[model samples]
Target: MIRDLARSVREYKKVSIITPILISMEVVIECIIPFITAALVNEIKAGCGLNTIIKYGVLLILMAFFSLLFGGIAGSTSATAASGFAKNLRKDMFYSIQNYSFENIDKFLTSSLITRMTTDVTNVQNAYMMLIRVAVRAPLMLIFAFVMAFVMGGRMAWILLVVVPILAIGLGIVIYKTFPLFRKVFTKYDALNKSIQENIKGMRVVKSFVREDYEQQKFEAAAEDVCADFTKAERILALNGPLMQFCIYLVMIFVLSFGSYTIITSRGLDFDIGQFSALLTYNFMILSSLMMLSMVFVMITLAGESAKRIVEVLNEKSTLSNPENPVYTVKDGSIDFENVSFKYSEKAEKMALSNINLHIKSGETIGIIGGTGSAKSSLIQLIPRLYDATEGVVKVGGVDVRNYDIETLRNQVAVVLQKNILFSGTIKENLRWGNKDATDEELIEACKLACADEFISQFPKGYDTYIEQGGANLSGGQKQRLCIARALLKKPKILILDDSTSAVDTKTDAKIRKAFREYIPDTTKIIIAQRTASVEDADRIIVMDKGTINGIGTHKQLLAENAIYQEIYYSQNKAGDQDEN
Candidate 1:
């Protein structure tokens, strides 16, 4: 895990190295300052000349200046290194997600990934900064100060031995108890973020259903879980402060009492006033360094869980990858499925699709109709290799999907999934996702085919009109039409519309289908729809039921011979007649 995370520090390696080096220099200078002060005091006590005092004072000032300079530069470099590491971590995680096959993405929740990328990354970033600077300074300061104290006060320096062990034992207990609580807290954070994400994304439905109070209560429950764990962790961590204070005062009392007695009894021979004062400075430095160490440990405990989560994403290999020697060009839109069976997960008890053997000729218009959960979308997703079939072969353009370069295969096979997503950008910008170099004429023609140009032209800015995230400003039909237009711009050899035109009126839907038949006849078009009218005009229609193809034939043939098709067609037509009545 450490090795995996350390890889993100790539370009910042130099700065990361420099930060600790500067911190070590600062610690050395700081330790020397206390010793210099003790000697200067001894000289003054002996009634030294003004020149001797001025020389010691100047030397001390120079040491202080160098310490400050090193400390300041270390702070800047540590910040730079930490921020760069965080950027790299986020970039790596995002790129990994982009490459992940649909099966891989399903392994992690959307909310969990978001938390790992944002909150978890921030926690690790702060810990990295402290690890580079304070972590280095604290240990060096403690060692140097302890050595100086031993040199000046002799046997009296042994007081730190007692305090150090006590503080170490206390910190160990505190950290051990708090570590589990912090781990639980971050898990709760994922739940809390999930609650907020679901609520905001479905705010429209929530309001329409008048479920504000329910959502609020749900959010509160998730928030309370996070707060409770954090509170428990904080309660345990609070012991560090009292434990440090007790140790500091215990050492202070022991040092002052012993040093004063020795000074009075030995007449300043064994332990003089100058040595006593320097020992006090060393005591503070040593204890404060320990205190810094305790804080660093606490931060590490918090970041440990975050680090694990981040490394999990970084180490994940996409379930689908290009072949070692991949075929780059798709011959045509031909699709063949032979004994294909698929389950969403290895642990799933039932296959989502099973025993599917079908063939689609290039440029043939195919329509699929199935009830919810019939795996209609699952059947089409395999064509583009979105999720590789768990059993048997799925071929596109006469080649197994796994044999083709992933990007090349996907570029030739365009899918407008059931969910229509429009990013926050100008209408033209969103359309450009399909073809980056598409000319204005190409854009208009594609929109016209999808029947999106009519609504887009009504906007004052036309194609340049700004679209809100997820196309919030547009109607459902408009969003669907625009998405279709974007897919149309791809000019793919195979286009699968997974119930994408459900939002548009039947007339507009017909126009889109007519456009496909007239303009892109050679492009194999597969449409998944609920309404039988949508598929009645297609060359062939597939009836799916419980993960298998129940019937495959022309619409008229299915209606004549297939019981399921008869039931669906007659029911929808009956409902339409009742509505007209």
Candidate 2:
């Protein structure tokens, strides 16, 4: 996992390397300052000359300056390296998501992905900064300070060896207990993010239903989980400060008492006032380094889960990928499903579409009708290979879908799914998604064919009007027509409309179908609709039931022969039905 995270430090490798080197330099210079201070103190005790005083003072100034210089450089380089690593990490995760198939997306929640990319990345960034700076500085600082104390104070410095083990053991216990709590805390972040996203997206419905109190309670529930875990973790981490202080004061008391007794009894021969002062300075240094180490361990514990989450995303390989040598061109619009079966997951109780064998000729107009959960949409999703078949083969243009370059195959097959999604952009911008370089005239022509031109022209800005995110500014029917127009701009060999025209009026739906027939006669059209009138004019109709094809025949033939089709037809064609033609 550490190696996976280190890969994100691509362009920042030099800065990452330089930060620790500078930190090491800073620590060395700073540790020597106290030793030099003890030297000058001893010289003064012996009534040294003014020239010696000036010389030692100048050395102190130069050492302080050099220490500051190295520390500043280390701080800047560490920040640069950490921020660059975060940027690369986010970019890689987003690009990986872009390649994820529907199945892969199903395995992860949208809210979870958002949290991993944002909150998790931030935690890991902070940890990385400390890893390069304090993590390096503290250990080296502790070692150097201990060696200096032994040289100056002698014999008494060994007391630290005993205090050091006790302090380490206490810190280890605290970190071990707090780590699991922090790990659980980040998991709850997913729940908190999900609550926020769902509330904002469904605010309209939530208000219409007057469920504000219910939503508030739900948000509080998620928030409380996050709060509870963090508080628990914090309480455990609180032990570190008291533990460190106790060890510091205990060691200082022993050192001061023992040194004073030895100096007085030995008549200032064993330990001098200068040696005692130097020991005190080194004690502060060692203890300060230990305190910094506690901070490093706390941060590393918090980031352990976050680091794992980040690496999980970076290591996930997309399930769908083009073959080694892929077919680049689609021959025609013909589609064939050869004994195919598909389930959303291996643990699914039943297949979404099972043993589906169907053949569609080029340029044929096929209508599909089914009750909810009968897999009407599931059937056509296979043509674009949105979800691969679990068994057998699905062929498009006389070649298996896996044999073709994914982009090349999908370009020839345009799907206007049930959900009409429009990004925040102008009408022209939305239309150009199908063909990036499409001209204004081409956009208008596609809009006209989809029967969207009239309403678009009625707006003040015409094609230049901006759409809000998720088409919030547009009506349901308007959004659907605009999506259809966008798909038409592709001029695809095969077009599938999966219950896309349901929001439009009957006359508008008929007009759109008429435009399709008159303008793109040779393009194979598959229409999935609930209205019988929508499929009455098609060459054939398919009725699906319980993940299988109940029947397939022309509308007239199905009305006479297929029991499922007869029930659906007469039910919609009652005396007061608006679909009557």
Per-model TM-score, in order, reads 0.98, 0.97
lDDT of 1 by residue, 1-581 (tens): 99999999999999999999999999999988888898888899889999999999999999999999999999999999999999999999999899898888999989999999999999999999999999999999999999999998899999999999999999989988988888888778889999999999999999999999999999999998888888888888888889999999999999889888888788557677888999999999999999899889999888989999999998899889888999999999999999999998899999999999999999999999988899999999988889999999999999999999999999999999999999999999999999999999999999999999999999999999999988999999999998888988999999999999999999999999999999999999999999998988998999999999999999879977998888888788977456545
Clashes of each: 0, 0
lDDT of 1: 0.93
Tell me which residue pairs clash in candidate 2: none
Tell me the whole-model lDDT of each prediction, alpha carbons only: 0.93, 0.91
Report model 2's TM-score to 2 decimal places.
0.97
Q: Considering every candidate listed, which one attains the maximal TM-score?
A: 1
Q: List the residue pairs that clash in candidate 1.
A: none
Those runs of model 2 whose alpha carbons end farther than 4 Å from true positions after fitting are: 264-268, 576-581
What digit string (tens of lDDT, one per residue) describes model 2 on residues 1-581? Answer: 98888888999999999999999999999889988988898899899999999999999999999999999999999999999999999999999899988888898899999999999999999999999999999999999999999999888899899888888998889888988888888879999999999999999999999999999999999999999988888888888889888988988899889988887788558678778888988888898898889889989888888999988888887778999999999999998999999998888988999899999998889999989889999999988888888998999989999999999988999999999999999999999999999999999999999999999999999999999998899999999999999999889999999999999999999999999989998898999999988888888899999999999999989987998888788788786244444
